[model samples]
Target: MTSAQVAKEHEGGEGNRPEEGYERGLGSRQVQMIAIGGAIGVGLFLGAGANIAKAGPSLILMYALAGVIIFFIMRALGELLLYRPVTGSFAEYSREFLGPFFGYFTGWTYWLMWVVTGMAELTAAAIYINYWFPGIPQWVTALVFLIVLFVANLISVKLFGEIEFWFSMVKVTAILGMIVIGLGVLTLGFSQAGDTAAVSNLWAFDGFFPKGVGSSLMTLQGVMFAYLAVELVGVTAGESDDPEKTLPKAINTLPWRIALFYVGALTVILCVVKWTEFADEGSPFVKAFEVIGIPAAAGIVNFVVLTAALSSCNSGMYSTGRMLRTLAENGEAPRVFRKLSSTKTPALGTGVSVIFMGIGVVLNYTVPEKAFGYVTSVATAAGIWTWLMILVSHVRYRRAVVAGRLPSSAFPAPGGAKLSWVAIVFLLFVTGLIAYDADARVCLYVMGGWYVALVIGWSVLKRRDPQVTARRREPEFEKL
Candidate 1:
């Protein structure tokens, strides 16, 4: 078959309908920043302390290694997105490459995954607020923010994009500010509030990797989890003004993003503070300022952390809403989910996503402390599944490419099969490691159960819809 024939086979024949809802509404800049913003989450700000404790200074290398794996994942996704730029990107790819059953399962699985993440984001907002008031109930706080963001999403897609733009900007500014400030402290050799130590604190204690390779392995869970949402770029490709233009730019820039955002920030912190101190205590970002004897650093970092949570919440809402609408488009969900409001946002889909997040309020009300970690683990598990699909999709896409089916395109993910296989191995390893850890073991079971449920659901869906037996086919253009 020719490339065009392959495209047609992928989209379910000539009768495959063009999308009616949601125009190419976002700018290239908005798309770029959204990708950057979505990838950099509160984990880097808050979870780094735990990672530092685990690998000692070697946590940096762990993040770098994880980034390499993630880069492959994104590259595979990028290739797939370039092939079929649709609202239901990943889910659609699963259907095209694997089969309808695979598509239905992956689509709904991803939708549920983001719903869990959205809930976790709302719950996190409450915890961050408590650092300030310490009096208000976390449930109330979570609900209020959820409702507010829900309304923002309902009003317009543009508003959601705008809000996310600024929210992401806040996160970027804070991390960049910390990097700049940390660099100054590193070079000038300023004294921390609690310690009169010099800038060699990073290696001064026991040298990097104090816990050996074991600690580094332990820390991979946290760092990789933080990077889980990086592929939100592929998800956003459908709504972009031009996927051909924007998606490639975003995917190609992954390396710098990993370096500057993850590596750069952690490097500065380790240089300024003793990894042992942060491991023994808490929040290296906040503690670094306290060490410098800045009285209000905690307050400032708290505010920044609060913004980070809100940013994640905003992105979560955006991602889940899109995923739900994509599911609807694929006939896996109710047709109502694919409907867009006058403002071109999936108003109903957005509402449903927020309602799912509202469940977080209940969790916060009933079990405030454990709610955050529980939801985070669940979200992580779901995200891992989504990434696994992306890897699988890429492998299948490459087979098509080699079969003389796919045209060369921008935004290529290197290491084709080799990296894809490595990423799959790493994913399984992460799951196994999670099983080993007392806290993360539950996620393994939860994700496993979720996939099983998805498979059962897929069987019912295939049985009910004879049309799903048809394959999706796409048209090919020779040049970009």
Candidate 2:
């Protein structure tokens, strides 16, 4: 039988077990849409302005280099997922191949990443709402946006899928429109009445590496974080209709998607306007639109950015819910998290995630400006850790495959062991950059605290109950 058929049969009833819960009818299109939907959010639309300012003309190289590194990371993840299509994805792979400590670190770190990102988006949504109704308090706006996402997640997995699909469509449309209009402005040399539109602005502004190569490297601190959620494709393997077929289709398309959406849009934007003009603007997207003569560019771009933030918040909830559910299934979390509603969604986990995200409402009120920076930096920490684990998992996986322990017919990452090492080292370099960055330095401490907490918890649990530890170790031993 086909993988889709197998998945359908596995999900025949309302079983909430990991094997069944993940087998809900997520077709290839839904999976593809979800992957794209979960990705391409506020980081690109709302956060790119900050990056554009940091690297100046060299911002293009920063994104391109980051994209290439992420491509290799995704391929490594795809290869690992093809062999073990589980709900928690990389967390599962880490547990199975690496060990319990790795699994514990990976799962909680990933969960924290989503939660923090969700809060950041929620807070950003409130700020956007303030743009329309400055009278409305930031807390109120955050509460409302959080409630909406909570409800959407509560209803059904498919509802979340549907919301993500439309959310992504809006982002995709904005990106494409920006790129096309940017090209038009470049070709026809159109600009605001006070300025001359010339493509030469791309290189004329203190040369391409105005800030030097170190500046481009510094931008990776944010650029890599922006691409963090791109691997949500693999996380859906368990819920997908055909892991073996649909997953590969989604994985294979990632390269093109990155090229067109990220590299393509950034390249065009840089070419259309001089890097000097991008500084201090809240959004380069708005600048691009205004330069193309779009009326009420601020409001139009505000709407787009609001949607992007909401989309990111929504995706953050979905990712957290799934990760927690997977943890529950693996006995790493409370069993209640594993419970699924009739819709095959992690009902309890979604509720908990929403509550966790609601903490942003309080943060929005207290220290508004610092909210975005704090969340992005912390999310960067989690993202790099996750990527590092995926690379480690791949290395272990190849060893298994080579020893005739795992099947070889699964999707293979290019260059085998070598590329995995390259990706790992590159990710380490990005982490080093994060350490060098003053804004991102706090992330190391935060993530370090998190690991310490997890280790303490694990140590206590180990002393309290040997059975729990054994249960957790069983799957790892068996898989390895």
Candidate 1 yields a Cα-based lDDT of: 0.75
| TM-score leader | 2
Model 2 lDDT at residue 429? 88
The residue-by-residue lDDT of candidate 1 on 178-265, one tens digit each, is 7887777766656553244445665667777688888689777777779867888877766787777788888878899889888887
Q: State in Å the error of residue 269, model 2.
A: 1.4
Q: How displaced is residue 127 in candidate 2, in Å? A: 1.0
Residue-level lDDT tens digits of model 2 in 1-480: 332333345443322245554535667777887777555777787678888887886777777778788888888988877665667787777877888668867988888998988888888888888888999988888888888888888787677778888888888888888887777777776656225556576688788888888877888888887787888887777777668888778777877788888888888877776677786547888877776678988887788888888887887787888888877776677888878877677878878888888876686568858757887889888988998999998998788778866555367998997888998898888889888888789999998899899989788767876565555333221332
Every model's TM-score? 0.91, 0.93
State the displacement of the C-alpha of residue 268, model 2, in Å, after optimal TM-score superposition: 1.5
Pairs that collide, model 2: none
| Model 1: CA > 4 A from native | 1-19, 191-199, 279-281, 469-480
